[model samples]
Target: MPVHQVNKTIGEINERIRKGKAVVVNAEEMARIVNKEGKVKAAREVDVVTTGTFSPMCSSGLLFNIGQQPPVMKVSRMWMNNVPCHAGLAAVDCYLGATEPSEDDPLNKVHPGRFRYGGSHVIEDLLRGRAVHLRAQAYGSDCYPRRELDKDVTLADLPNAWLFNPRNCYQNYNAAVNLTSRTIYTYMGPLKPNSRNVNYATAGQLSPLFNDPYLQTIGLGTKIFMGGGIGYVLGSGTQHVAKPPRNERGIPTSPAGTLMLKGDLKQMKPRYVRAVSIVGYGCSLSMGVGIPIPVLNEEMAWFTGVSDADIQMPIKDYGYDYPNGLPRVLGHVTMEELKSGEIELNGKSTPTVPVTSYSMSLEIADELKKWIEDGKFLLTEKQEDIVSL
Candidate 1:
């Protein structure tokens, strides 16, 4: 590790926040300050920088502890709103994956599956205080004789509901394009044939992991804003690439670090935790995640000061390379270029659309900033730092 010009601890930052003396800003503002006054000065002046990202995260899921019924049946199979949930845990405990399509969904019956309803919808409905039909089955046992269970339950009726996502908030991702002659529907949204359009999902510099590229201050027990509520970083999320290809600025130019997050579902709002259905890809959860980066040193300030123009994403071909698992890089494009609605590809200006909502990310960052400013939120020292290679 290199020597830092400025040093401030999480404890010091929290104390300043409690005293209403902490200087906080969003990632965009931090970038501007660093550009104007330099990173050393920005580190000394800014206590924290808030970052956010809102995108369709398919790896999200819910853990539920449905109330026990009369006779105390041990659930072996469970379904909530026609979507199957893993009930291999304790009697009434179940895990509902966001992308688990409903049993009644006509998946690819007509060539492309229209997964209208799924686990993500069920979760959103529950959070909105709507009733969900629950059904379960179990083989009779001596201690627990009940074999069947059926009921309609709301979030309030559940003993515990946790939004425990395996992965969320990817640091950076690829900009997808279809090189084939036919249109294709994928998780990145439908791609027009012959590279007619580009679809990318990420909040660029406003992304949490991007602001803390090396995961210097983000780790186990790090407090965060998740789905419009308080949450924590359980650890480095699934598919976390410790060392990915980077540009000159040390920012990853491809899919990289991810976060495993958990929060109380009861505290989350419907708006921040939405259900999404891709045209033919299937169901997913569009969630909002915001993380506060403590400007503990000049290095931290420099990382958080990255702007969209400074960040780049690899161009990928969804029609072939991605599906074939080939590591072929079509090219690279900057977030500024992607957000400009177009990018040059093979001498043609291709239309670009962001699957992730940058505006929503900005709102989350601002909301987190308000929480810190009002002393409703504070920073936490990580019990263990996320591994970096």
Candidate 2:
């Protein structure tokens, strides 16, 4: 393995990667390295660490400008795969949120849509090269007298299709367990009644923000794998709750260090980005994201060396009122305990299942490592610091 200067630079790392001398490890491998060799030793030896995650990020959405809707008047309403899209941007531009349901679907009333299909599904179908029904209603205008447009389109048909996520890749997420007498469904996945099971969201130790606690290296303009294509960190994500309480190791306990990201939808693949509708919840985007962390120094190495056993998350009651006050925190437990298949909560053992797949995370990390090794991917400088933003 080739060693970089005390202050490692992206250029040096890229050069080493091209030479096949750069040492890289995924989250799982990093643990073994740190365990046997120690953080300082691993820091001095490894060139980079790969991190990945896939989860139901509701703040994500797809933006598109379908220019083929020729002579289009101001579009008042738009529907993609029966899901209504926000057409307030311009005549050809619209935004479709992952959690947005079709206008015809009720919000939890007389009839349940069961969320058979939604915006996320539409986006996925388009990415899969499948045609989607596009219907638009417009107000007649002088230059464009057309009042309605009907067509079938894929992501390739759009002049510009983009994935613009306002928030994603949460640094740390809450562990949800239901205490009520009935099964409760939340974003963390379905929680059984009487604390039968618990569900967690983050990829645990494999999560990018968790490895880069305090937002040291990750920032705006950083290159990352988003929805199977190359994307850049846009900025600080929305509802990025501030200065969340940290654990003894400085890792956050609450959801934190969220990020905004953007990428060309045309370059994405269906495998990395999928549309999923939660049983009771509406539409949502499930995506796999990969980020490479350069081993800048021993401090950085230590941060990345932190494992699932070290980082902990608070158990929150999904049934509690979220807007008024903080959810009830049953306790702070480590991911190792949560991933052990069951956790002892309040004297009763509760089964814990992961909504995110660790095996999939490994696959993403391996793919990203290959990109780096082939010299196709390089670390990027931050356009702006996320912490200050």
Candidate 3:
């Protein structure tokens, strides 16, 4: 029967029980519960038989059978169908946990093979992103040797710093040059379970909700129009990419999804802040495990109206101000004096430490107070152990 028809039939049977024209009866049946894998986890055998009879004088007679037992054959059939249903649900849950990819998944275009540069194979730019000078240049580094260039030499005229003597270079060099989608692997939990030899674009395809464009926009500088376009890092993973604000279409559709920046770089020191209010999931922002830092400027603070607090510290002595300074001092604080109330900090009663003082010592002192209260580090034991004992 169709679902609606089955429900209608059940409704009629229920109506018969309510009316005085029906005789009531009782019965019992068997049931079982099973895991998604179709393995039966529980089962119970039951006996069901209803006793009822219709009156001979009644033209429209009713037979009522109720209590515990429905048809065993029908119930068993539904129960078996539910087993596959449960199994499918569980498999989907496991797939979500085990197959989800992360933002750091690398991008490469070519698979590494037995190819040598300058001898048999020619080098090519296989990855996206404009090349920037290495933070530190080493003498005789694998980086391309600097060549004398004319005054008109552009970035294109520069040597390919990425190329190396492939034959003698370390294995790491080869991996860097020839990496491709097939060489990528994924991890499940702490274990590297499978070698995912799929296209690089397909890395994080498992998560329908995941969007890297929104992340790339985070901490990016706001563009202030001038006669010329503001400088931008052009290419993959750069902030110049157009990100859709939270709207009808786009990764983020709300203010929380929109990325914002905080702090003035012109100050004595730079600060950074996250303007977007993100919700972390198992690894997302709501749970707060992942660290999404401001790109470069370190001056930062998180502001929630009514109770404003500094979440970022000054780049210089940011450590000192952190736990006992102007900003809400967080982290380890070791106080020699015991105070009864919440530790209030400021110029008035804040304990100041010399810049040269060891931070670990302060941490130790703070821990000592807790130990003393717990009676673990007794004064008498300290005297006996340290002094001529």
Candidate 4:
């Protein structure tokens, strides 16, 4: 097997980036280069590859440090815009999950209600400089006297607003379809009866984890583009499977790795962090995330060279099998075939749609590349690698 004669270090790559001399390319471009010139040549020429994904991440949430009341009341319960928040932390600190539905939403009274607003909408409203009604209940105490508090506050009024997402950027995911006769709604959107339509989410070859497969350069303390601002990888996210089944290209065929990410909400753009509501499911936050992989060795170069055709996802039946906790997989399909607007399944050509925005992902990857080329972004050495088994 041929090997690249050059082996670069992250420090060397950062130095070159600082001097505006580093070679940076998006994952798509790197795949083409590897396809034509092979991994050996590609590794010798490229310094960095940028990857991106923009999708509805339900595990995302916001952390806020609302200022204490005048008498220092200890908040026992809190609600922002009628959406309940987890207030078991400090006196004034609270965490609001993106999927928390409003208490007054008609879903409580009606089946398959349209969940218009929820925690995600409140988050977006706050980020956009809008004030939300805040209500808190507290048990009166001698040290902390004030009990009831009601007011409207904007993001600026809070001491700290942070986006702490437990999971985002799923490495690979399921292509959902309905196997029953009736329609059903899920986080993947609505599925038509009898597998009439398929919905999948991922940026394919441009996804950060897909490009890094084994978590080589992506890990703790690795800097990334989070919701249009700089952020850091906290650790392995929830439901992250270290070792899942793989295809010939060494890519996971099932839902695999995930990222735990955190960033300053004050620096995020409203465009990159928006609210989304499923017809019958609930609310979620759609976010844009980008990770840069430094080409430090032949293996790194080869991994970044993976393309849509090389990546595949398992097909899952959401109508009956998934809801019943069955692990049966209907089949597998490549990202290339999914992107072509159709796929052959069960002896029929089925229509498909991507729940995530591929165009936004491309824009993010391009923007990250520009940040590196302009000497504004620098790669960081990971303190520890994400778990890989």
For every model shown, what is its TM-score relative to the native structure? 0.98, 0.94, 0.13, 0.97
| Root-mean-square deviation of every model | 1.1, 3.0, 35.3, 1.5
Q: How many backbone clashes does candidate 1 have?
A: 0
Q: Rate the local accuracy (lDDT) of all candidates.
A: 0.93, 0.82, 0.16, 0.93
Tens-digit lDDT track of model 2 for 1-389:
33533467777887888788898888778878888898778877998999999888889888999894456577889999778899999878999988877756555344464575778888888888899999988888797688888889878789999999999988888788777788766666677887788888878888988888878778888999887789989888997765888888789887778899998888888888987867765668888899899888777787788899988988887765432376668888899998899889889888888888887877888888888877788788777888721
Candidate 4 residue runs with Cα over 4 Å from true position:
1-4
List, in order, the clash count of every candidate structure: 0, 2, 16, 0
lDDT of 3: 0.16
lDDT for position 195 in model 2: 77
lDDT of 3 by residue, 85-197 (tens): 11122111100110112222222113222111110000011111223121111122233232221122112433321111101100000000011222222110111112111
lDDT accuracy of residue 120 in candidate 4: 98
Which pairs of residues collide in candidate 2? 98-283, 99-283
Better of 3 and 4 by TM-score: 4
Candidate 4 local distance difference test against the native? 0.93
**Error in Å for residue 163 of model 4:** 0.8
Candidate 2 stretches greater than 4 Å from native: 1-5, 104-113, 321-324
Write the residue-wise lDDT of candidate 1 on 90-117 in tens digits.
Answer: 8889999999989876664554567888
Could you tell me the lDDT of residue 57 within candidate 4?
98
